[model samples]
Target: MILVTGATGHLGRAVLDTLLQHTAAHQLAALVRDPAKATDLQARGVSLRVGSYTDPASLAAAMPGIDTVLLISGGGDDDGLQQHQNVIDAARQAGVRRVAYTSRALQDPGTLANELMVRHFQTEDYLKASGLGYILFRNILYMDTLPLFTGPTVLETGINLPGGEGQVSYALRSEMGEAIANVLLQDFTDSRIYHFTGAAAYSFHDVAAALALASGRPVVYHDVAPEVLAARMRERGVPEVAIGRTIGFMTDIKHGQESLVSSDLAAALGRQPTGLLEGIKQLYQL
Candidate 1:
């Protein structure tokens, strides 16, 4: 059986939805901290293994009878590296054949001083050292986050950021989940890594044009300075830490860190991934 950690989260749920289409529900299990939150999954005949990555004992108890485990990256404020280690160790102890990890798609995570990417790199290193076979899904930024970066009134105010002209090969989260599920259904004898990304890299200017086409209204992209963007966030009462993180990601884009386009996502899906204009329309419901 296959078990997915963080089963109640957005990407986890999307993976489960696609898995259910190709396999029987009884062949799947979910690793959840609270079974109450996963009642829908239990009703669908998927076994629920209550566990927490912070609690090694819980993770160990959740691993019996599972052939493979998908360790979805944690999003909490706590130490994520140790949590991932706990899961990996538990899976190893339980004799799980393979462990799949969701990681960031960066050519060199050390280029930037971002703490999150550092942890991802650390986790990947630890997983590699662990004796079990592994699959690494180095995913790029999601198209779903476009709304968060640009405000709700983006159609009127335009896309203003410090990302400069650098482009991101952003893939839809749902499509990435589907591709991950496809990998999970296959044999896990050989370990592999995939750079899951969209078909093309696009800049904020391309995003503006896509928005204009989708909404049938004029839109613009303003390449503001980092200090100017930070000042605007301060005016809007955004937290200082969040402002720093936002600027850090924009800087990574400015340096072309997320500009690599890969065909792995489309190869997994057996078709070309959605283009920017179509993805924008789907995201905005336009």
Candidate 2:
């Protein structure tokens, strides 16, 4: 069976559903922390394996008969290092042949995203060191979160940040889901890594324009100093760690650090991902 950790999460759920449609639900296992949350998935014929990264015993039990394993990084914390290590260790002990891990695109993200990226790097390192056949899929920033980034302003004019007109290729969650399904089914004779991204990059100015058009509202793009922006967030009671990292990340984008689109994902999946405008149009119901 193919087991998916964090199966209850957004990306995981998306991946799971797509996997179900593409293959047999009976052959899939969803490893989750809460059984109640998985009632629907279970009733739909998925095997629900109760597990958590913090609980090594639970993790081992989940992997006992599983074939391919998708180790999605743990949720919402610096705790990923420990949790992922536990999961990987358990997988090793259980003799799972191969592991597919999801990681972040920007390793040195100066944004609030770094906490998890750091852990993703660590988990990936552990998997490599453990001498197992592994697949590293580095996911880019989710295009779905763009709406969240502009939430308050979205209700009126849409929020704007100092994105320096930098172009970043971001993919929709569905495309990511489809690509992951492709990866899970593909032959992996050699150790491989794929950087999953969208078909093209759009500047934040471009994003502002598209969002405005999509929502039928005027959006503004205000470029400010990274430190100044962070200071304002700090004054708004944003945590210090997140503030520093977010600002640093903005600086990186401002300088075009992650401005390019990638073909690696398409090569891996044998399919092209959706473009930004198309995803935005669909998501916003525009």
TM values, all candidates: 0.97, 0.88
Which candidate gets the maximum TM-score versus the true structure? 1
- Total clashing pairs in model 2: 6
**Candidate 1, residues 1-286: lDDT per residue as tens digits?**
9999999999999999999999999999999999999999999999999999999999989999999999999984558889999999999999999999999887568796455667887899999999899999999989999998988999999999999998999999999999999999987588999999999999999999999999999999999999999999999999988888889889888888888788999998999888899999999889
lDDT of 2 by residue, 86-156 (tens): 88888888998888899876634444323435667778889999877898888877888776545444536
Off by over 4 Å in 2: 107-116, 155-159, 231-245, 267-271
Q: Report the number of the highest-lDDT candidate.
A: 1
Candidate 1 C-alpha error for residue 91, in Å: 0.6
Error of 1 at 248 (Å): 1.3
lDDT of 2 at 257: 54
For candidate 1, give the lDDT of residue 6: 94
